[model samples]
Target: MLANFHQEQSTKSTLVYLTLSIDVARELTHVHLERFLAPLQCLRRLELVIARDAKRQFLDAGQWENFITEYLPRLITFEFKFSSEWRIGQYKLDQFRSPFWLDKRWFIAYDSSRSCLFTVPYFVPTSIKHSFVPVSTNLTTLPIEQHMVFYDRVTELRLQEHLRSLPYRYNHVKTLIIDTSCTYQNIIDLSKVQSLTVDISTLSLSSLMTAIKRSMPCVNYLSLNGSYWELSYMSFTGISLEQVRVLCLSRYANYQGDNTDKWSRLFPHVERLIVSIVSKSQIPLLIDQFKNIVSGFFYIDPPYIEPHNNDPLYVDPSYIDQIHIDAYNQIQVTHEWLMEHVNRFRQSNMDNFTYQINEGDRLSLSLWIGEDDKTAQVVMNSYFKKNIVDSMRTVRSKTENLSSNTTTVITDTSTTTTSATVTTSTVTTSTSSSTSTISTITTTTTTATSTTASTTTSITTTTATTVTTTTTTSTTTTAPYCTTRVTFDDIPGQSSTSGVVPNGYKNLNWTNVLYLNSSTMPTSGYQTAVNSPPFVGYNPGGTIVQITTANGTKFAFNSVIVSSAWRDNLVWSIYGYRSGTNLVYAPFTMSVINQTKISCNACSNWDTIYFTSSGGTPRSGLTGNGTEFAFDDLCISFGY
Candidate 1:
C-alpha cells in the first residue's frame, strides 16, 4: 500500500499536495518519501507529526531542508509539529538554521509552549529579523546577558507556565496571554504587556483585579474566553480602566447569562469591543452604555470546533441534534436583526462595523471597515484574496413554483400566518417572470395552464366559458418569489477556493470566468501599458495587468472590486487594457432606468468602466457583525 501511494503521487508529479500524518508509516523508507515529494514542485503546505518514541533521532533537520528546497521551491506554509517530548538528543532547530529560512511573522508558536525559552539557535524576536520563534526542547532559560536584544520585535506574547515555574521577567511584551497557572505576581508585575487574556477557569475574579491594579496597570486590550460573568461584575465594579481601548469577551461553554452591561460600565473608556452576545435583549442596553465605541466582531454562537465530517447525510440526517437545527434557524433572524441594528450603531461613534455570518462550516461574509483607506486596504487584502463569485453558475440555489394546476376549490378558509419559510420542494428551474394559475372541476371559475403559455376551456359555448368562469370566483392568490445564491466557494486565482467553478456557460450570455495565472487574463495579447496607480493592492499586485485611465480597451476587459480609496474616478479605472495603438476608445453611455432620463450620449471610445463607493457602513455578512470587507473578490469581464 505504501509503495502504491508513492507511485500514485509520482503519477501526478506536477501537482502540489499536503501530507498530514500523526505518525508516518514505519515501513516507508527515505526512498518512498522522496518519491512522493520529488514530483511535487508546488507544495504550498506541508505538515508532519512525529511521536516521541518514534525513530526520529536519525532525522537531520538540515537534510530535510535541503530536500524541500531542492524539490519544492514554492513551499510557503510549513507547519512543523512541536510535541511536548522536548528532551536532549532530539531533532533540534539548530540542525535546520544552517541554510534554511524562518521568519517570525510567518511563524506561529501555538498554545502551551509559546513562551518556552529555546536556547540554541534561539527563535527569539531580535533585530526585527527573527520576529517569532525558535525551537529546542533540550535547554532551559538563558542568562539575561546572553539575550540582550531577544524580545525587540516581540509585539505579541503568550505565557503559559505552570505555577511551579520560576518567574521570568518580561520588560517589553505588548500583547500577553496568561492562564490560571501563572502567579498573581507575574500578572501584576508585567507593566509593559498591554493586551491581555485572563482565563476565568484558573484565576479568581478578585485576584485578577488585584493583578490588573498592581502590575498590568496600563493594559488596554482585554480578551476573555472563559465565563464567570457574575463574579467578574462584582470584582470589576470599582476598578478603573481609563486607558483601555478594546474589550473582547467570548463564551466557550457553560456560559451563564449575565446583566451584560457590567463590562461596558467597568470599562467605560473602551473604544472598540468584540463579543458573542448571548441575548438579543442586551443589544439596546449595550448601545445605551458605550455610546462612542469604535468597532467589533459579534455573533451569538460560541466558538466551537466543527466535527471532522461536515456532511449531514454521512451521520444520518434524521439523527441531527436539535441544537444544530436551532443554530441554523437562528441565523436568518439574527442576521436581519444585526443589519437593522447597524444604522443604530452608526448613531454612536462607530464609523463602520462588520457582520460575520458563517455559511455552514465553510465560508462567511466579512467586509472591511471603510473608516480609513489604509486600514480598509489591510482588511480588504485579508479577505479579497479568498475566492468569491463572478459567474452565477457556481451559485447553489433552490426553486419552487405555484402552478395553475395546484388550484383548489375556494372554500374560503379564514386566515394563516407563518414566521418562517418552510421548504417542501427542491425542484430548481429558472424563471423570467412570476406566474400563477388556478383550475378546478368543481363550482369554481379557474384559469389553468399546462406547459404551454395559455389555454382556453369550453363551457357549453366558448363565448359563455369566459363569462361563466369570471362570475364564479372573486378571490385571487399570488405566489412568493425568492432567489438563494451561495458564494465564497471559489476565489478566482486560487485552486483551493475555486470549487465547482466550471468554465462552461450557465447560459449563452454568461461564462464562468477563471484565471489561475496572469497569462490567462486579458488574453495575453491586447494589454499595452498601465497608466493609473493601483488603488487597493501592492504595486502591480499580480499577473493581471490593471486597466487604468485611458488604457484604451482594445482587448476589452472589465470590472474589478477595489476599495473606494483605491479607485480613481478622475478619468479611467483599472479593469482592462488597450489593444491597438490607434487606441480608439469606443465611448458609449449606459443609463440605468428610472434613476434619470433613459438617454445615451457617446463620449470617448472607452468600452470599460470601473467604479465603487467610498464611504459607508459595511456589515460582516459572515458573522452578522460589521463587514470584513477586506477579503472581497474582483473579476475582469471579456463580455464575449
Candidate 2:
C-alpha cells in the first residue's frame, strides 16, 4: 500500500499532506518506510504529527533518529509533533548535539507546553550581531518597532563603536524622527541631522536643541510635539532661534505667558509667517510685532466669530492696507486694498518695499495717466474690447475740377487748327520758312493765315513764306522753384570695376595720372573754372575722353587720381547742384582710392572738392572758397 501511495503521489505535481492512521504505520516495515518517505521528497514544508499509538512500536527513538538524519535534510522548514506517550525527548537531545542544530539556518519553535523550558535549547548564532550595527547613513524612515528599544541606548559606547565601523557614512541627515525617549548622548549623535522631529518630554528640550544646533544648523522645518514647552525660561535660555526657518508651534497655550517674547524672537528668517490666533485682537499684536520680517502673513481665524460684520466697531480690513484679510468672499475689496498699498509704496520711492497680501490672493493691477497711457489704452482695448469707446470719427476732403477757357497762338507758314491745351506760363514759338504743316491738338481751336508773296510772280523760287497764326489762351500751371536741402555725404564720385572689361571697352588703356589735385579742387563754396589747354571737358554722364597709344591701342581712364598733401588732415568733400536760378547744391564726400583715383564710370553730375576741415572749413590750394578745372587725357571706349 505504501509503494502504491508513493507511485500515486509521484505522479501528481500538487503538494499533498496526509495524516495516516497508527494502524497503517505499524503495518509498514523498513522497506515500506523508504517508499512512504519517497513521496515526501517534493514537499516544501513538511509537518509530521506522530500519533501516540503509532510511536509505541513502529517509530522508536532509533527509527525516528534514522529518518530525521537521512530524510528531513532537504525540507526548508520542518515541524515535528510528538505524542504524549512517545519517549522522544532523549532522542531529540541527541539530535541537537550536532553543531549544525545550533546554526541559524532554521527557526525552531518547540511545543513548550509539553517540554521543560530548561531542557529545551534555544539556538542563537553569533552572526546575529549584524542586527545591532548601522547599515545605512540615511535615517529618514526606519522601522520603529524593530529599533524602538535602541533609541535611548543608540548613543552607548558599544553601539557608537559599531556605528563608527559602518562602511557607509553620512555628512547630512534629513528628516530624522525620534519617537522614544532620547538621552543626551543620543541627541549629540543626532546633531548632524538637518531636519528632525521628536516626541520627547520637557526634560529632553535641552538635548534636542543642542542636537538641532549641531546636526541641522539650517533646519527649515521643525515639528516638536509632547510637553517640551513646559520648560522654564532659564532652562531654554541657551537655545539658538536664528537657524529656524519654519517653526510649527503647536499647542501654544502650554507655553507660559512669559515665553511669548522668547517665541517671537525665534522667527527672524521667516518670510512667510503662518500662525493661529485665539482672539481677534491678538492678530493686530502679532502683525505689529513681526511686520518688519514678515512679507506674507496668513492668519487662520477661529470659527467662533461671524466673519461678516457691517458694524463700524468691527475690524476694518482696509486699516491693514499691506495685509490681505479674509472678510467673507469679497476679493475685489481686497484687490483694491492691495493696490492702495502698492501705490503708496510707489509714491514713497522706496528702494525696498514690502508687498504683503493674503497667501493665495492674486495681485491687483491699476491704470493711471502717464506718457504711455495712449499706447496702454490701445493694448487694453484689443484684449478687453467692450471696456473701451471710440471717441473720434474720420474725416476726408472732396476734390473739385474747374473748367477754364484757353486760347493758343501759333505762327507758321502752313494753315492749321490750334488747340488750347498748354498749361505752362511760358509761350513756345515754332517758325518754319519752308513749306511745312503745323497742327495743334487741345480743348479749343482757332485758325488764321497771312501770305507774304504774290502768286503772279513767275520767278522760280524754292522759298515760300506761309504765315499761319492761331491763338491759344489758357491758365498757367507751373509753380515757383524751391531751394532744395543739401547734405555732406551725398557727393557723387566713381563706380567700382570688375577685372573683366566690357567688349567695346576691352581695348581701352587707362593711366593713374593726377585727375584731381589739391591745387585745382574746390575748398569751400561753389565756383567754376574755365577749361585750359591740354585740359578737355569730359562729361562723366555723356561722352568720355579716350586716349590711344602710339601702337593704335585705345585706352580710357577707368578711375580719377587726386593729389592732396593735406589728405589725411582735411576732410575732402564733393557735391553737385542744378545749374539754374534756384540752385540746390547737395555736398557729399568722394571716396578716394589709393589717395587719388575715383572711378569715373560711377560718377553722375558730380563736382569734387577738398576741405581743410569738416563743418564748412576749406583747405588751402586745399583751403579756399572753391575751384574747378577740366580733366586731361581722360579716356573713353570706341575701338573693338
Candidate 3:
C-alpha cells in the first residue's frame, strides 16, 4: 500500500523526500511528514519504494559512520533492515538507536522480507553536529510534456520559501518553445521569454493574439505554424503593434475563409515575414492582403514553376501531377487572384495614367499633370510583364477623353473698328464691317439705290469711308502686338552722386566707393550672383566673392567669401565658372591709393564692372588687352 502511495505521489508530482524499507513505517511516516513540518516548509513527498532482503542491507562501520555523520543532529527520518536471526543488542542500541524526543526529528525503518520494523525518533541528548546540505542553484529546463507539473511545484515552493529571499525576480528565462499541447495560459505565463516558437494548432486565435500582445513586447524572433490564423478573433484582440520584428510562418495552406481583415489586424507591425505555402501564385495575394501590415514578406516555395521551352515561359498548372494538386492549385489561384485584386485596388487610386508595352518585355508608363509620378514609377517598375496593365493604367482611357475635348482659343481685337476673329473647336472666323463708310446709312427690306454710278454707286460716300475703315481693321487684326512691364533696380554702389538722375538720361556713372577690410561679409547688403562663378581660381580650391552694402546690412554674390583678399581682389578677376559656361568675377576695381595699402572697390553697383582697358603697363610676361575686364551692368551702359 505504501509502495502504491509512493508511486502515485511520484507520478503526480515527481518530488521525492526519502525512501523507507518497511511498509508499515512508510505508511505512518508519509502521513505525518507534511503535518509535522513547518507551515511554510516544502514537504519532500516520497516517490519510490524499495524492499530488499535483510542480508542485502549489510552496512560497514565506515558506512555507518558516514550515515551518522550526515543524518544525525537533525530530526530526520531513516528506515533500516535487520536479518531474521538478528536480535536487538545493548551495544547496537547504544551505538545506533535514539528514543523519540520532541526536540529531534523521527526516523522510521521497515524490513519487507521479514516483515520486521524499527523506528528511531529524534533524541537531543544523543544528537551530533552535522553540516547542512546546500540546495542547488542550477535549474533544469523541463520538457513541454512535464512543464506543467514541474512549474507548478517549483512555483509553489518558490512562493513559499524563495520569494523574498532573492535579490531579483525570476524573469531571466530567454527562450521558450511551446509544442502543440500547451494551453493558452501556459504561454501567457512565459511572457518574459525573449524568443518563442509556437505550434499553431495548440491555441485558439484569441489566445494566440493575447499571448502575442503579452510576449511580443520582448520577443525578437517569432515562428508560427501555418494554421495560426485559424484561432478565434478574440484571441488577437489586444495584440501589440510594435513588438514583433521577424515573423516566420510555415506549412500554411490556403486561407479557409474570409480571413483577410483578421490577418491585417493581428500582424500590423510585422517588419520581416517569411511564409511557406503550397503554391507560388498565392504568395502575391497573401502579400497584398497583408502588405500594409508588414514591411517585407518573403514567399518560399518548392521549385515547381520551372522555365519551359527555354523561352522564359513558366510551366502552366505547376502542380497538375503532384499528390495534392487540387489543394496546390487552389492555393495558387487564390494567390494570383489576391495579387490581381491588390493591383486593381492600387490602380483605382491613381489618375491620368497610361501604360504601354516596350521592347525586351518591359513596360513604360506616363503620368499626366496632377498624377503622382513616384507612385506611377513604383507601379511601373514592379510590373513583371509588359502586357500586364498595372492598376494605374486602368483609367488611362478616361484621361484620353478629357484631353481630346480641349480647344485652343485665339482672339483678335482692333481699334479702327472692332473686328473680332474667334477661333473655337478648330474653326477660325473673321467678321469685319465699318459704320464710317455709311455716314447716312439707311436700309430697306426689298430694294436699295446708291447716288453714284453702278460701280461706284455700291460705294456711297459713307460706303467709301466704310470700305477704308474695313481695310484698316483687316490689316490691324492680321498683326497684333502688346507690351509687358520690365523693371530694374540699381545695383549697390552704382547710384549717381546726386542719387537721382533725370528720367531721360541715358548714361549713368557711379563713383566714390569705400573698400572695407573684413574676413566675413553680410549677405543682405549685396546683390550676389544668381549662380556659381564661371572660373574656379584653382583646380580644387575655388574662389568665391560677395558684395556688401555700405551699411553692411545686405550682400549678394556667387558664393560666400571667406578670405581677406576678397575685398582687395579686382572685381573682374575670373574667380570661377557658372554652369560650366559663363565667366564670373568680383565686381570691383583695385587702385593703389597709398604707398603701403590698396583700395579694391566696386566700380559701379548699378552695372557689373567691365575693364575696357587697364591704363597700367602689363605685368611681367603678361601681354595683350592689359587684362581688359568687361561685365554686363548699367554703369557701363555708355560706350564710345
Leading candidate by TM-score: 1
Give one digit per residue, the lDDT tens place, for model 3 in 1-640.
Answer: 4335544354433222333343323233322433222231222222222233332223222343443344332212233333333333333333333333111222222322244333321100111111111111111111121112212111101111112232112222344455544332322345444555665464565665566675545665566663535544565556654555555565343334445456656666554455544434444455455544222332323442222333221223434334323342221222233325455335555333333222331111111112334322112222321233122112111011101122211111111343232223222222333211101111111111111111101111111123442342212221111111101123244332112112222222211111221111122111111011211111000111111122222111111111111122222222212222222222223211100111111111112221111122222221111121211111111110
Candidate 1, lDDT over the whole model: 0.34
lDDT for 452 (candidate 1)? 12
- Which prediction has the highest lDDT against the true structure? 1
* Model 1 lDDT tens row, 142-218: 22222222333244556555444222333445566765455635322377566777764656656666667667766
Task: After superposing candidate 1 on the true structure, give the runs of residues whose Cα lies further than 4 Å from its correct spot.
Answer: 1-122, 125-161, 164-168, 184-189, 232-237, 252-258, 302-640
The CA lDDT of each predicted structure is 0.34, 0.30, 0.28
Give each prediction's root-mean-square deviation over alpha carbons: 26.4, 45.5, 41.8
Residue-level lDDT of model 2, residues 1-640, one tens digit each, is 7667755556643443333333234444556655676556544334444444333433343454466457644443333444343333444544444434323122222222332111110111111112233312122112221221122212112111213233222221334545555343432344433444555544376666666665555455555655435545466665655655445443342333434445555545543333333333343344344433322222332332233343332443443333433343212232233334443324543223222223233222112212222221101112111121111101121211111222212222122323222234534433322211211111111110111111110111022233455544433322111112111112234122101111222232221111222122233111111112212221111111122232353222122222222222222222211121111111122111112222222112212111111211224333212111223222222221
Worst 10 residues of 1 by lDDT: 591-600
Q: Candidate 2's C-alpha lDDT?
A: 0.30
Off by over 4 Å in 2: 1-173, 178-181, 199-207, 214-218, 226-238, 253-260, 280-640
Candidate 2 differs from the real structure by a C-alpha RMSD in angstroms, to one decimal, of 45.5
Residue 446 in candidate 3, Cα distance off native in Å: 99
